[model samples]
Target: MRTRPIGPYGTAVSVIGQGTWQLERADRRTAVRALNTGIDAGMTHIDTAESYGGGAVEQLVGEAVRHRRHEVFLASKVRAANASAHGTVAACDRSLRRVGTDHLDLYLLHWPGGHPLEETLAGLRALHRAGKILHYGVSNFHDRHLAELFARTGPDEIVCDQVLHHLGDCSAELRVAPACLARGIAVVGYSPFGLGSFPPSPRAAAVLDSVARTHGATRHQIALAFLVREPHSFAIPKTATPSRAEENAAAAEITLSDEDIARIAAVCPVPADDGTPSSASGRRP
Candidate 1:
């Protein structure tokens, strides 16, 4: 797996990571095999959340990596409802327990809910001080949310943001990614396949098929390769099938040329190659 430093703070993760959403909701054996296979294929950064199957997926991740934890960069998240200082602490504690790890490589707030950011960050800092988490970030946050955060804390306090970014959605790139890149924070794209909920349009499908055929890979691999091409961007695609997990890991090896990236971007609505979004300052890292 190709690795990059996720943030200035020094967390190097695989450019193509593993997302374990609902990984253990059905057959426990299959879920464990997928996790293990992905890791074996050099999928080092594994992400999960408290709301993923009521924490069952975290347990599955724990079991899958119990013997090889050092080989993986583990990330987990707490729901927005638990954004309070005490709630955040308690939730992270449970996550650590479920994941069978004393400390998380990265911890995140699942979203910006009604809770006060100060209280939430205080709890996250508490975890950091106690060595329960190395870095803290957020998910599903836009530019305004990032503004609010930078207003209170230094820009570097948050290490990354995880968002739904795929062939059909470039919302994060338009609103969140430039802000993150400016501050030297990484952006991790989850649901690269749209959580199995979104299907590509015919035109987008054709674009992906064309790129995939050129690379001798599946369309899904082409879709994921687009995300990792962006500077300071990573992708974590989740699947409970072992074969699919292996395939997802292989996507990291398919390098798309500038033309392939631009063709996909034209169909996906991401900013033009001239710049990431609005200004020349948003250039890819």
Candidate 2:
């Protein structure tokens, strides 16, 4: 339930945010229950996108947070195909309508393609200037893309980069992490539990199990704790169950020792030729 500052924007988001990609397929009651459970557990950050379930997720979020919008740091992304200035502007308006919000705490470029980097940056800048979005970020970007985007837009405008980072996927450590760290950009790590490929490696599992026993937490909780323990790092693990939501929120209080961190890092997967881990293939988006 603790919060972490998301980049230099001074916005403090929940350490364990809720990703709403899977909520699109859930029925109304189920979706509302899951969202309410997350809020009740002190999870104040939620990530969604306009493309998710053709805007169904955003609509559900709107309904769930009708009277509690101020309690959560809501975030959503614009698809790569809608990367132009015009596209982004219109998309942001549409997102606000769907979510029943006037503004977003963070708005991200869902992918790193489909338009010129400058165009995308310009769109984000316009949104910030218009007060439609508080901060701007990117997802699914590589080192080269990060460099190009930052170079064109300057570092201050780029707040964070959401990427796949977990025990089974630590490829971001090679370049993305260092680049963001040096530039003062926060890293939002998605799929912190490897998207259901839990209990990563024997070494990692052993370390996690030991830490869990010490904290009376679950393996998944220990796994998430490992990510948020890093400076300027955040984790968003999706879940539809109330029990799992509470378990994830409890991880914020589970601090890992230096030895535990080193052990977990040692077993993290290495990057492949594409600069992404092999385990990332298991991720749906």
Candidate 3:
């Protein structure tokens, strides 16, 4: 699979990773098999959160990567409600225990919360100093959130910003993406398919169908490829089926043409910059 640099430190991560939003809802054997299959296929960046399935999914992820943890770039998130300095550290410890890992490759604040951003960054920095986490980031953060965060912390302290970026919504392109790119912070797109309501419009469906046929791929694969087409972008699509995991991983090999991107843009136009907030509805924290 193709890879991209995730931070200023030059950590390479697969363009297409694995998202464990609701993996706990899947059958135990199938979910484990799917995660292992993804890793075997080079989708080694597994993203989970302490809030997922009330932490049950983290245990499942631990089981899947138990023997091959060295082959994976493990990441997980701490909920907003637990963004306090001490709470952040405590939450990470619990996540580590559940995932059966001594340290996380990447840790993130699930979203903006009532707690001050300084406390969260202090907590993350403490973890970094303790070797409990290699890097830290944010998810569902918008332009203002990024501004506030950068004001309190150096750009190097942040590695990535995981947000809702899919074919249906490209609002992140307005400011969040540009700001991150300027700072060398990767934009890791989550829910690239958009609530399972993909090919949001007839025109989008037609464009996707044409592109998929041209590449001999499925619409889903085309969507994933499009999401990670840029060098600073990455994606984590969830799947509990081994075959689907393979399909998602294959998207990394696809190279969409300029014409193909233009066609997709025409059908699924990026929303105009009207100060509308990016969607943060998926994978609740």
Q: Which candidate is the best by lDDT?
A: 3
- Give per-model TM-scores: 0.92, 0.92, 0.97
User: Per-residue alpha-carbon lDDT of model 2 for 85-143, expressed as tens digits?
Assistant: 89998999999999999999899999877799788878898999999998889887777
Rank by TM-score (best first):
3, 2, 1
lDDT for 142 in candidate 3 is: 88
All models, RMSD in angstroms: 4.9, 2.4, 1.2
Better candidate number, 1 or 2, judged by lDDT:
1
Runs in model 3 with CA error above 4 Å?
275-283
Top of the candidates by TM-score = 3
lDDT of 1: 0.84
Per-residue lDDT of model 1, residues 1-285, tens digit only = 778889778777899989887666658888888888999998989999888888888888899999999898999998889889999999999999999999999999988864999999999999999999999898877766788887877766888988878877677787678888988889998878774534468788888899889999999888888888876999998888899988999999989998998898887886445543332121110
| RMSD in angstroms between candidate 3 and the native structure over all alpha carbons | 1.2
